[model samples]
Target: MGSPRAASSRSRAITEVCEAKLRMMGGSLRELESGKAAALEEEILRTDAKLEELGQLADAAARDLREDFEQAMELLQSTRRVKEHMLVDHRQQLGDVAERIAALRSVRDEGVKACEAADHAEMVSFLSKHASTYSQECWQLLARPLPRSIQVPLDDIPFEVAKRRDLLRGAQCSEKLARMKNEVLCDIVDALRQERSTHADTREYAVEVESLLEAYATEWEKRFDYACSYCGQVLEAALANEPYCGAMPGRKAHHWVPTDTAGIAEAKETARPQLPVAAASPRLKSQAKIRAISPMFRADSSV
Candidate 1:
């Protein structure tokens, strides 16, 4: 065996070597922990900054969306008011035209009956007395200044010799004018009805769009709230790949699931609004349908 002093010296050298190695390892471990802490702090600051930026962006987006929604609402309201006024005007005009058409038909029918019952002399006298008045009335239906070329004499001729020719001409002019006015009034009625129907369709579509916009605005307003409820701040943080409510560490994201709200259920069940269209008149079907003022002045010689 070696001397005891030599053995003790060897044991001391081994102990010193082990102590040096342990110190080196402890220094390396401290550096690693410090580096990790600094990196974690930097990540936290960066994430907070990102969150602030996202909030600002969301606010700006919400503001723009609200402005657009308000503008759309204003436009819809104004359009609705204008359409209501137009509908009222159309109804009034239609009623006036209907009454006028009925009066014209009644008077024309009476005149036809009178002409059918009259002898030649009575017929001639009747035509002479009423032809100018009837002609003027038909010309007035134009609702504007008449052309100078198509003149209707304001008064009947007093001369007995010229009565037959002038009276016949006046009656013919009255019949032609009446037919033209009738056609015009019928066209107006048809156009008015068609416009009303078109307005109804347009209103229906507008209502549908209005509903959709309202729903969109509602959802947009609640988007942040929904996000908060769904994932809490964990989703906002860069912690988990999937949504989490409370904590991100060691917690699974499989507990909560989205369910349809009452509003969504009601929307699905709701029926779309549809406006009724005006029905077309059978009498005012076509312009070519001849409504003669009298059988005597019938151009096609058909009653």
Candidate 2:
């Protein structure tokens, strides 16, 4: 009975030891699982951080690309506008030149006709006889040698009357030629003045458009940090002193200047006077004088 009881106690002790070992093994397994969970959590956090960093980098890259693309587009648009203005200006110049050429041809034709009329033999012979007679009279008055004058009645003069008629015709033709020449000269001058004015207007408009485009580009560039993507330099430094560039200096906010359009219009209205219809030439001359003096008074009063 004592041996059996000792054997039973030994078996119980072995069971207790086995149970303790199992508990220890279970605790170690729990510790390993906890460590694995912590490691996985840390890995997840690291992956999230890496992804956030990548996202930030991607956003920055996208912003830079967008900025660059916008700048390129603005430059292209500016170039296109300038080209269009130039093409229009060139076309206008060509048209003006063609019109001037036509005007010159017309003037040349008029001159050729006048010259042909002046070269008529009958007219020339009549003018020559009058010239001889006038020269003789002039020489006699100046106490110089005079040719012998044929004394004949006016109606009985055969070639003398014809000579006088030819002289009158030559004088009339000369006056007509002079008037035509003056008209041609005036037309040419007017055409030149118009061409010059048009050219000036075109240049002014082109400059204004270019300035507007540059101002827009400048404002857009300032929003993108004004940095050159290619050279990594500050774009402001590159464009500080440049008159025209893809990126320009930003304009400071300014107060709007007041316009005097209404005042000018009012002043013009007040100064402008109604004129009476000129029935006589004297009244017309008086009106002209009044008009000329009115401008001076208007200028002084406005000032």
Candidate 3:
């Protein structure tokens, strides 16, 4: 064994070395903690930036969708107006033709009865008195030119018969157009709804937008009721103050402007005053004509 003094000096040297190693380890631990904190702060900042960017993107998408929906509604409304006008005009033309036919038929019936009259002198007197009137009527009916669509007689049919065929063709054309308009409008509305559901990030926003659209459509329809005086194409009850016929000459300039739906609730509070109901029109009796036969034939179906 070594002496006591030498042993004590060796012990002091070992203690000093151990203390230095502990100090070095403590310093490394502090550095590691600081580095970790800095890295955590950087991650937090990046996450915040990403969240903000996503929010902005969502807002932009919503705005674009709303604008697109509005444009589609505008197009639908315009198309409805045009098709309604065409249907109204065609109905008027048919009414005029029917009136002329009834007049001609009355004269023919009188002539037929005269042929079978037991009194020959009375029959002759009746024919003589109406001869000039019948001739004038026939001349007037022939003077009117054929419609533009009847470019030539079909299958070499008589001119009068061809005119009647052209009129029938026009009626068929109107029916086809009304059907097509209804289809297009339905497709557009469905597409708008689908797009809204797809792009909206939140359910609440989607419902709100959908409600607004429905309210707008419903309100506009409620305010304007158009029934054609001639064709019986009734969209609804006639507007209390407005003329019922949409196809009346000099009425084309008048149009129904949809009430803005942004403040729909407010609009409902201050609705237009209802006027006293007018007497029912003669056309009201035929309201169940073509529109009743085919629901797709309605101009308002698309709207």
Scanning candidate 3 in windows of ten residues, the lowest lDDT window is 273-282
How many angstroms is residue 64 displaced in model 1 relative to the true structure, after the best TM-score fit?
2.9
| Candidate 1: Cα lDDT at 23 | 100
For candidate 1, write residues 238-277 as lDDT tens digits: 5435544454456546343223355333433442211222
Cα RMSD to the true fold for all candidates: 52.7, 51.6, 48.0
Clash pairs, candidate 1, are none
Question: How many clashes show up per model?
Answer: 0, 0, 0
lDDT (Cα, tens digit) per residue for candidate 3, span 197-238: 766645644454444445545645555444444444544334
Q: Write one digit per residue (lDDT tens) for candidate 2, span 1-303.
A: 579989999999999999999999999999988979889899999999999999999999999989967876676676667666766676676676566556555655654565678867645565554545655544544573233433333342234346668999999999999999999999999999999999987776555545444553453233234334333345456454644333334533222221344544554565543333424332234444444644543533543
Model 3 RMSD, rounded to 1 decimal: 48.0
Per-residue lDDT, model 3, residue 214, is: 53
Please report, as a residue range, the 10-residue window in candidate 2 with the lowest summed lDDT.
Answer: 251-260
For residue 201, model 3's alpha carbon misses the true position, in angstroms, by 66
What is the lDDT, from 0 to 100, of the residue 197 in candidate 1?
96
Find the candidate with the highest TM-score and give its number: 3
- Name the best candidate (by lDDT): 3
